[model samples]
Target chain A: MGATFMLGELVGGLRRNLSMAVSVVLVTMISMYLLGLGLLAQRQVDTMKDYWYDRVQVSIFLCVEGSQYAACAGKATTTVQREQLRAQLEQMKPPIKDIFYESQADAFKRFREQFKNSPLADQATERAFADSYRVSLTEAGKYEVVVSTFQGAPGVGRVQDQKQLLDRFFAFMSVVSWGAIALSALMVLCAILLMATTIRQTAFSRRRETGIMRLVGASNGTIQLPFVMETLVSSLLGASLAMGLLWATVRYGVGGYLSKALVDTAFIGVGDVLAVAPWVVGGVTGVAVVTSWFTLRRYLRV
Target chain B: MILFDSVTKTYPKATRPALAEVSLEVERGEFVFIVGTSGSGKSTMLRLAIREERATSGSVLVAGRELRALPDRKVPLLRREIGTVFQDFRLLPGKTVFQNVAFALQVIGKSRSIIRQTVPETLRVVGLDGKEKRYPHELSGGEQQRVAIARAIVNKPAILLADEPTGNLDPATSREIVRLLDRINRSGTTVVMATHDHEIVNEFRKRVIELDEGKLVRDQVGGDYGTTTSAIPVIRLDEAGEPGQAGDPGETGEVR
Candidate 1:
């Protein structure tokens, strides 16, 4: 019966202050939506890191005809020299997982296929490139070992770790993730203060009823339960709305328009969004409940 | 029953006490009138009885509980046992007449079955049975005071304190309110009414305690309103009959 009375008062109080109540809902929804967006961006960055980092390879390009390295001698090292280098590379402790030797002809074929529609494809030839060993590390961070080993070795002109390039790519994304999280936090603070003030005003308007309740032997919890429930109800409405908006944005707005327009890399997938749904819901509900409890504690005493 | 022992209540930053060393007692089921002019500590006395204001010195006992020693948590329980009717008829404007009366029982955690059964019966006692659904603003002054009365007694508290319950009503309506209060008193609820209305005091001829400048000037049993010189002329002429009339002067005027 006590719970029902409190629930009734909560509903009645919300109805009595419709404009303020709507403001609370809107504030909470918009704040949580921004927060959800930030989380989605962070998730996208993590996924991109995983996808690109796994495929990255450190490539050691062999010397060409005019190269000045001592190991190169007068011309590109012979097939026996390349074969010896490959065996030496594999013999290192905690050995590289696998190495693929691409001949100049194979590299040229890949180049041609990649630039099939470009004018450069017509002028490109196998001799224009070099035979290289594309070394796949067991882990991306092991590129340092491969680079140090092959830097001054025979017939090695240049060592390029694709993981470094991927790191630079994701570095930019980390900045964006941080900025979005910061902005969302600021907006959430504003929304929480707004919610607290709105509830305080609601309590002020009904102070007479509260005073009477206090005099009539109602417990402090009994007096405060209605306002707390009011805040929670408004926050829950806001959180659910925010989740719906986030889902729609990720499905249509981000997935369709943004992803297609800027297809520099793979974006967040629908599976990732589904994975983080509980976190988003839990974060929103927790914020709403906690803010309401603290605000009511300060204002509803007496 | 109520007792005050050398009770003194001084507000912050005020030199003098609102109630200064006042001591009084009323037995159970007795109807006592506390009469004083404005600012003579009448309201403070009632507030002390309800434990709304703690005495700065000494103690107050209400219904056998030490009010001054009661903690904030227990104050509400003390109030539940002592019903208070204010001059403003402090009914919640949002609630219906029935809801206002039912609120007292609701606060005490009475079952819904008991609320439904007792509210109408109590309203009938105050002659507001059929007007249950009307809001306070919809009722006349007299009707509102009656609703306040019904709310006060719904819990069947040990004591009923009315701080000018008829302050807003006309003379005839005021008389009716006093009659209702008297009826409640006869039914065994101790009643302490504070009023400045001299006519009602003399007419009812209940025990009256008078105050002046925060001091108890007179306390008399079966006290008339004319105990003090300034109060004599304020009594109704028809009720007081001939001038300088003494009590129980046999055949002072014709029966007709």
Candidate 2:
């Protein structure tokens, strides 16, 4: 009798507030979806950083004749300075995993090949280019030691770490991820408030039943179980909708479209969606139960 | 079986007490009437009996259990043995009469078979057997009160506390309700009623306990409406609506 009566109360409550329950589902779905995306974006940025940072090469541009850099001093690098720089780099082995030298003609050839479609390739000369050494570090993150050692040395114009450029891109990605997470938090607050209002209204409308229940010796738990179950049913629906939408987004949106468009970058797949699905649903259920419990405690008071 | 040992109750932000140093007792199987005008603390006395309100100084005992020592968690257990009815009927509007009465047992965790058997029998006892499927709004005022009464007595509570059960009914309907109460009382359930109807008080001539300004002024055996109290004018029963005209079909079944 208790179970059937409780079921009756739950079903009747949801039917009475069908539109409000739908609103709760929609709001919870959107918030959980955004939260899932934020988590996946963070993972995507981490994967990309690991992939590109492994191959980042430090470029040490050697001075050419007529070069305007103060270190270059309008003098072309002699064989001695060139050989000395190479020896210095070779001695720094272990940290310096590999090194390659490009001559003036090689630099000019590569420049022309890279800009073949540009008009500047037609007017460029070998003297306008500079020879350089492309150094690959075993630990790409430790490029600072190599850069400090090479800068201001004779015949070297500049030492540029490729990691700096990648830093800016990853920073922007982090901002996007964190910003989505923050917005998801705001929407979650809205969902909680909406659910509280829904429970409060339902409790108020059924106060007569509750009062009679109290007079008839119904315990507080018995009076509140139906209300809490009402919120839980709707929130579970919303959570399931959220998980389904997230799976579809990762399966089709990221795996199908994004992976094909950006062929080289690794994006989050459906597996990551599965990983975050439990957290999203668990979090939403927890909030719904707590909010309903509190609202009923204040309003029903059985 | 109810006892009030100098019980005093002062509500928050009130100038005077609702019940002040008043004491009374009703033995088992007795019909007791708590009478006075409005603000006589009769409702407060009932609330204290049900442990809905705590006494400010003294203690209240119902069914031989001191209510002050009862924890809030155990209040429901105390209430299950004491059925209560009010003027408003307090029926769940959406539920049918059977559901309304069955709800009392359902809340206390009665089984389905028990509910199925007990509900119809209790409805028959309240003279509402055929109207089991009717909702509250579909019934007349007297029938609605009957539903409330059925719900209250369905659990076979030892004590029945009625706070103005017939206040909203006409003279004829009120007499029928009082007759029902008297019949239930004859079946060995103690009835404690609070009312302003002088005719019922005088006609039934039960033990009347009158309260004046939160103080017990009169306690009489087989008493009528006395002269000191300012009572509502008695409405005489017409010939067509005499007391015996309302047939008693419920006497065959014992409520307990």
Candidate 3:
């Protein structure tokens, strides 16, 4: 019966202060939405990094006809020297996943396809390209080992890792994620302060009722339970709204644009969003509950 | 029952005491009137009884609990046994008359069955059985006070304290309120009324304890309003005679 009474008081109090209650819900929703966006962006960055890094290869370009290999005693890297390099690479089987030899003609053909729409496609020739061996690693971190080993090889002019070419993209994403996180933190702080003031005003408006409750032998917990429950209700409502918004963004917005833009790589799968949705819900709800509890404690003393 | 021994209350930053070395006793089921002009310690005495203010130097025992030594957590429990009605009525403006009365039982964690049975009965006792849906603002001053009385007595408390309960009502309404308090007293609830309304005091003729400059000046049994002549002899005897005579007068006058 006491619990029913308290629940009734909480509902009745919310009804009495409907505008402030709505404001609290809206504030929490916006704050959590921004936070969710930041988290989703970070997840996207991780997914992209995993997808692209797995396919990155280190390429070692062959020395030219008049280069150091031609002047050496081996002279133009005989079959013996080629076999020696191949054996050395084969020995690194655990770290070097696979090695593919791209002759000068194959390199020229790839360059023509890459710039097919540009004027540079007409000027590219098979003899102008370098014969290179592409090395795929089991992990991105092992790229440096392959690059260093091929640097002073008898027939190698230069070794380049494709992972380095993607540095600018990851740097840009890092800046965006940091900005989002900072803005989300500021907004969450505002939401907490707003929630505190709303609860305080609600309690003040009902001071007469609370005073009577105090005089009539109501426990401090009993008096405070209603206000705390009210805050929880507001927070839960806001979190639910934010979750819905996030789900919609992931399903409609990102699925339509981002997935198509990065067709070859996985861009935030629905399963990943579902896996992290509860955490977002729990995080927003926890923040709302804690902020409301502290605020009400100051004003209601319960 | 209530007992005070050498109770003294001094406010911070004030040289004079609000209540100075005062001692009094009220027996069970007794109706006593505490009377004094404004600032004469009438409200302070009532505050002490309600545990709102602690005495500086003395002990107060209410229903076998030492109030002066009681912790803050126990103060609310002590209040549960004592019902307080202020001049302001203090009804929650948002609640209906029914809810206002039901709140008393709700606060003590009473069962729904008890609340359903007791709230309407208490309201009926206060003569507001059919007006349960009205808010306090909609009720007249007399009706509001009746609602306040219903709330105070709904818990079946041991003591009832009313601080100028009729201060906002007309004279006729004030008499009606006094009658309602007397009716509650008849039902065996001890009532302590602090009022300066001489007409109500004279008509009721209950025990009146008057305070002057934080001192207990007169304690008369069957005391009438504006009749200080009978109190003078008792005071003179209390000052000049033996200490035993002081205690005798309280009993003798009370008996008469």
Best by the DockQ measure: 2
Which stretches of candidate 3 lie above 4 Å from their native place? A1-3, A64-84, A103-130, A164-175, B11-15, B225-256
Q: lDDT of each model, Cα atoms only?
A: 0.80, 0.86, 0.80
Off by over 4 Å in 1: A2-4, A65-81, A92-95, A102-131, A254-298, B224-256
lDDT of 2 by residue, A267-294 (tens): 8778888888888889988999999988
Q: Write the per-residue lDDT of candidate 3 for residues B49-140, one digit (tens) a residue.
A: 87778888998888789987888777778888888898889998878999899888887789999988998998888788999999999999
lDDT of 2 by residue, B1-256 (tens): 9999999999999999999999999999999999876787989999999988899989899998899999888888888889999988898888899999998999888999999999999999989989999999999999999999999999999999999887888878999998998988999999999986666887899999999889999999998756445332122112113344223233112111
* Per-model C-alpha RMSD: 5.8, 5.9, 7.4
* True contacts recovered per prediction: 0.33, 0.65, 0.59
Candidates sorted on lDDT, descending: 2, 3, 1
First chain TM-score in every candidate?
0.82, 0.85, 0.82
Question: Residue B11, candidate 3: how far off, in angstroms?
Answer: 4.1
Q: DockQ of each candidate's interface versus the true one?
A: 0.37, 0.56, 0.43
Candidate 3 chain B minimal-lDDT segment of 10 residues: B236-245
C-alpha lDDT of candidate 1 relative to the true structure: 0.80
DockQ of 3: 0.43
* Tens digit per residue, CA lDDT, model 1, A1-302: 34555566678889998888888888878877787778888888887887777778889888777655555664886678688889977885454777889887899999998888889999987777888999887788888988998987866877889988888877888788778778878888887888788878988898877766665556666677777778778877887888888888888987888889766667776676677668766876777678777877888764
Write down the TM-score of every candidate: 0.83, 0.87, 0.85
Question: Model 2 residue A194 lDDT?
Answer: 93
